[model samples]
Target: MKRTVFIIWLLACVCTVRMDNFTYSYKDAMRCKEHICRHGYSYETFYRVDANEMRSINVDPHSVFEMHIAIQAASNGHIVLSEIPNPGVSDPVYEIVVGGGGNKFTELRRNLRRNAKSSVTTPQILSPIELRGFYIKISEDGLVEFGREGQALPLISFNDVDPLSVKYFSFAAWNGVEAKFLYDCPIPGDTSIEDIPNSHPEEPKLTPTDKLKRTLLMGRLPSVPPNPVMEVKLGFKLTSFRYNTLDSKLTTTAAVVVSWEDDSMAWNPDKFNGTTNIKLRQGQIWKPSFYVLNSDGYGAMDSTNPDTISLASSGEATLHFQTQTQNYCFDTTTTYSRWPHDVYQCLIVIEPWEAHENIKIEILDETDAKFEMFSDIDTVIHNEWQIMTEQVTLDSAMWNEIIDLINSEEVLNTHLSDKMIITVDLAKNPDLYNLVFYVPMLVVLYVTVLFGLMTAVMANVLLISNFGEALGKSSAMKQVLTCGVVRAVFCLPSMKKAANGDYSVQEDEDSSYIVDSREGVEEMERSDKEIKYGDKAELAVVVDKILFVVYLIVFVGMLAAHY
Candidate 1:
């Protein structure tokens, strides 16, 4: 009855499984490769400094921690056991090795602090067989015990070594040898032998078909047998967006989330026989393509541009890019009162090119993603709370004979969707104009126009009218008269015979009667050959000089401003 109740309670409780140890074996490699083939993979997920932070096992100064290591001899190579120090620490580093020199164990130590002491030990004896196993016990006080499991006494023991300082342990097999970690557990110092379980659970093994699928998905195999199907489940969330009036561009930031169903699915080309050729980089399999629709025009984003946002990791990534504001539906006449109903839509698609078989990729509806646009000061300007979901699946066996089609230039233009796959509705706010700055500018413009008009009228009166008469008593007007008179001799008109013109010109030397050309009329010349009209001609010359100076000044100023 107790056992039954315990089982029921266990079944009713939710369990979360978190990996805390790096128990790598051949099976682990197969699983890692399978993940790489079907989905995106990052090596940092395995060995990054932060990746194993949460997985670190706390070591008390006086506790017994047991690490079980197993090595199966390969036909050609050996296994190595390495101890990596905590990311920031550089002390108490070393390694214990096996299966390399004449089937005997070797202990390698290096980079020890000047005064640091270690008591690490190794097994002395080996069975002629290629397989070997050992359990290492670390004590709270830094004593290390090394021997085969279930042995009454450890074959080797190190006393007073600070094993607690070691951050983690990694195992690697070279050539043909296979290194496997069987178990890692902390045993109480006072616990007896009978309290521990006799055996621990092992990881599930992969079948031959699973191995083939992994290889094919990774593109490790050049080709596969008939019927290949791939399915991907994906979703995305818009984290941020905004309009930049300075650049006249709209910037959007989004987090694209992707996942896959646990079930193994495949497609047979023979059944759904159609062909569509595609080329894609393995990294691009999970990348989400963005399409923007706005007042400007419709087009795919510039994914090749440096600022064209692209971010990707194992399963998700954050994307950020700046697009033009005209790309969205906008209205210039709409004010803040009508902005509540304004909506802008953007399309997103996730597709990869040209698999020889049919594959279906679906974007799920329950993504709960929203796009929000904020002002430069982080004031909310627009929000896209609704996302329309569309799942598009394209398949055909039009596989190109060439395997490395990634080099093709046309791949850059390829989009995941021929039609809109997913649409997001963005509510745009009315354009915000700063009246404080603009109103002042408008007032300044009106004042400048009034001042310019007044200046022009005054200058025209001064330059066009009789300057000497207007300022008759001014000393400059007398100077003007004198200057005009000095040049009056050359101002005399050259003479021409009758040509039936209205104006007549008489040569100063001839003093002959000259006829005005237009009416064939003749006017008697004065007795003096060099006739000069004193004050009237002098006033005209003064006005012309003033106008030329003013015009020259205005022309040079305009040219300087233009360049």
Candidate 2:
């Protein structure tokens, strides 16, 4: 049972290469207007494993091609694989063609459907077992192998075809017909039919004599694997604490060091079934992994070959990577002076897939990989004296406690299982500060408060006193006693221009001229008396202005003390 479980687990950890297909059909041809794939007559076939990485299939003159080809309904068109120096030119191109019985090179039945459904169900040189489908493979050595799609072995093998005649290999077709075709290669390095089958073992294997007995009994081998499982690792960490702060970005470096012992007691990545390719899963919010090692020693993760991370004869290998976060100087949620206080936590993470086939991995977080963010709000404090000072500090223990919680295993697992979190709480309003710096200004403000209160009381008494004339005269004279001589001179009122012309018009429009003249003399005397009272108004305005100024100064000073 233990062996059974290990086998199951190991099977799950295996990662396979993706197979690419080149198809030919009516709808596809219309999309490819120029009979070209993606603007090029031929596509540069490559597969992407990550956003920053891609693996391409290396095909040279010696490479061979094998694929399953099919057709929907009988048509005049044919499937052609050829090399074209210039795609448009019809010059005698080196090519291989497959079609129904009418062709002179290789003959096939006219009605492929009838032949495929016949009782014999056997592949032949002139008639393939399947009506609309067949299997074909061409080697660089001029060997062409052809058979039915589901047949056990090749029905016919043709030899002696020169590969040098064609410069490049491409798939194309003529006329109209519905068809399907795709390459069988999946992983980058795999090139042969046997390599794929052995690498991707889908079914349980049987002894040779049992397999022969089964083939004799059923005439075919089983096509599916018994069990399939996928394996993945836990997580990765930051090993270095030395972080660099450049402008608005914060950068930190980390490495994944994996080691193991072999039968010869030699430690290496290969000894542990390690490939140059190391697959990693990361949180979406985190930045893409930046490979650290340059192109040297054993191939780094960033190498053109991403399959391995190896050490040069050393016991262990290190896969170094870094994370640089922007706007790291300030909380993303809060900027300087914009808010009173803010706290933020930014995470850098990397995790690999589960282990299988005796492969083991180790993740390190030596730096603890975390830091706290505080602004001027945290540094400056409003003291009991209401002065904002830098002497204030927060409890170091509280900060340590928070850090401990962050580094805990539970929290780490929570983050790895969920999306990454980068958060900033809203800032609290800070205490407002004062701009007062001089002692005289402070003393003057206090004196103004007392003086203004006294003046207000005296002014109120005069308003109610019926000692109006005396109060008015004293109010004007008081400016002199109040110290500033220049201010006193400026406070003196000017006759400026009597309230304009309406009085002259009133005199001219009088209906009883004689009586109006007698009353007008009396009215003129009253007007002079009113003008004298107007002077009292001017004095009141002056006194009110002084008191207002004094109150303003006192209010500012007191507010500063409280802050």
Candidate 3:
């Protein structure tokens, strides 16, 4: 009895199984190639990344492309794409490794650089003896995703926001491994879907069960979007926010609640047992393509995307996602001015991968764009960041592709463009910066100013000379910049350099700082006639008073700009 109950429980769980790309092709417009022999098999190409020779193909930036790849070796194979086209017979030398570690493990690379420390692992995903089908999708917005026969999301994906146009591609295999490729569209005459391992895998028809999937997939292909326009309602909540002072990056974690109505799911109640509701696995049905325009990695391909959909007999479908994105702060310049008091506003753009003509994203205002949860800032976020509930907003925006497609046609432009923007407002906790770095620096600054005042009043030349030569004073203050503390450390150098109006302390390319005047110290022209010591003595006093005023002006200016 326990074993039978366990089996029933397993059947109730959802599995995200998305269909391959073949469904995206228009049914009426899809015309098969003519007069081709199925067994000719002459068109099939065999190559390897580990091998010396390979095949190159061109990619379109404005369109979506699919590829069928088969590798027998469990842990090895290669798919190299070059953004920079080659000079004549050779392919583009610059390559992005989309798939270097076959089915069991794979790593995406930017030229020679590795994307992450961990490899994407799906053990024994490919059969050791037979060719298993996988689809590589190259879409607009610089998104590249590959789906295996049985997987929830794209197994290997990469996205570059301002993506490079793929101009060349090649297949290579490490020495002992050889991969089979079937690149052209339209299979040869009368070929079975199973034989062509690179073609779209046929969808399996199964009865409804809670664990593996649903009956809605029986006669429909969810991978294909509805014609004309499909409206998707979005509910967004920013669950987490953190900023890295070092990387100048804001790590944002959010939850998006989405709902839409699918016409195909409208079933009659009398069918059986008042079948009014069904909850299925994600991969087995059609779900929206969620992409973050400013994602640090491949947009929709990352872990934050969702698949679970709840379907009501009335046609309403809902899905949920817990997303974390490493985002670039649009307002980076403000960080330096505000410091502890800085309020950071980072833009999070979410959109469908499909064009505007196919899908539309509608942001619901209530569930707070679904952002209302942020109002209780004390609970939503735990970092040093203070969530500004009032400033948090969600609005409609346009995708880069749609923006480029826009022109002077005002009337025809209505109901076009599909994008949603979420702006997260967060303030720095001043208590720490005020207590740690700021207070100490303020103390040193005032002490140095006081010393300058005394020396100016005394008119002591020897004291002024010591002040310029003292490395001890400036070194610690210079450390206030702390390397990429970005570029130069705004520090107070020696009284002598200040005297000459040469108060420039520069950080070297390697992040090491140096104190130098307009003239080099070692090569410094020190002749008394050239130095005019008495004149400098008078100017140093004036410079000290000017610096005090300059510091006040800068501080006030920063406050005015940031608040």
Candidate 4:
């Protein structure tokens, strides 16, 4: 499965090349007042992957060319469509940008400067498939309007005071997306369009596919359960996911397939040349729109691809709702408080936006298992976190009560009568944090306490000369420091002598830290009259014992909290 990529901005300097694959149908035109307006000149082309590609049609006013063009493109890349009145010189151009630089907006620009923008209607404009159509019109008064084929209002509009006549019309796709642009669509009465491959013919007889759709009342909704709730199966095919630690938001990318049976839409294969399926788009038949109950302020559950609804001859209509969503994670404080070792459970609640008394929502039994299996092999960062479990459950009663509560007060709202909740169990991987931060901190704390312990135990011997002589010069200490066997043999006797106030050194091994015996015999005479760091230094060394105990306690507490 493809992993979700973080949003990136595209530079103006991004280079583009011409696409090599191009297929065209007959020139589509309708006879207008002064000239012929081309309606459908279909072109199917494949853009090179990741290499920003540019394509254009030169609508020279001097020649007999189409002034208006319709484009139906399928892509999830940055699209910059511009019209240059003066083609050669690159200034003072009108531009229409969609999904620019991976952001989700449609912009209208003058001279490459943004004038207005709106939310992009389509999602997953990445891959080129199920091509849908739109129209762009350049009015006579330097005004431009663009919208989907049948949309009443233009999605993008720009009016220019100093406008030039439209000449070079171009569109470019950026950032590794392969795009398909279909244009020059035939108007209602263009017979030449029939020559195009797969162009639906005006058949005199209705086929089995047509008959089945007619019987099912393709555009209407199915009736509610027949004294029995009609169950609709919903399942998720998770492609990838992303989590933002800063915002505590989780974005899930899944192909949510919904299936239902409409008996009238089905037919036996023997009567229809073994025809098993016929496809439809979103609005052509009754469809359900799923919404995220926990939107986290950016509550959008949009279809990545708006095309491709499959209907089997059995009257079963299945739609692969390619949804990409950004949701607010719940109970994050209770889940994320433990830092690197934290485990969180986020419930992604999905509810059918439409309310019906007869329809019921259901969760596929294998949904959790399938999601877990996909998580294991998905192309996400391996050592970051794990999707410990995935569970999808139906919550009809809960949603019903919630809807009632929402409707109790005087307010206008649209809520689900039934809902499906997917539980995602998440846990962080703590290995890297432990190795890089926790272990080093623990070692430093322990070493500090150990140094304090040694200083407190041997202050007189190792620091000030209060315990008669240095522990370094004692025969017993030398044996302990140099040889393990010798130290073991003399360990009990040395301890016994120390208890008797005899931290004494052997004659041959006698040494002092205060002054050297042979070279400082005179210095020792002066040292008898002068003392450096006497009682104050001894008192500080004695406090080390107390501090050592306190330090050990703190370190123990720190360890307890860590685990």
lDDT of 3 by residue, 320-364 (tens): 667777777656675777667767677776756544445666765
lDDT of 3: 0.51
lDDT of each: 0.39, 0.34, 0.51, 0.51
Task: Please give, for residues 485-556, the per-residue lDDT of candidate 2 as tens digits.
Answer: 533454533232335431221223445643234666668556645544233455566667777877887688
**Per-residue CA lDDT of candidate 1, range 206-316, in tens?**
444434334334643323312244354444334456643334344455444333332212333233232111222424233333344332445544433233212112222
Model number with the top TM-score: 4
Clash count of each predicted structure: 19, 17, 23, 10
RMSD of each: 21.9, 23.5, 29.3, 19.7
Q: Estimate each model's TM-score.
A: 0.26, 0.23, 0.37, 0.44
Q: lDDT value for candidate 4?
A: 0.51
- Per residue, candidate 4 scores C-alpha lDDT tens digits across 154-266 of 76776666654443444455444444444334332335533221111122346777776565564565433322445677776555667777777887777666777767566
Order the numbered candidates by TM-score, best leading: 4, 3, 1, 2
Write down the TM-score for model 3. Answer: 0.37
lDDT, residue 169, model 3: 47
TM-score result, candidate 4: 0.44
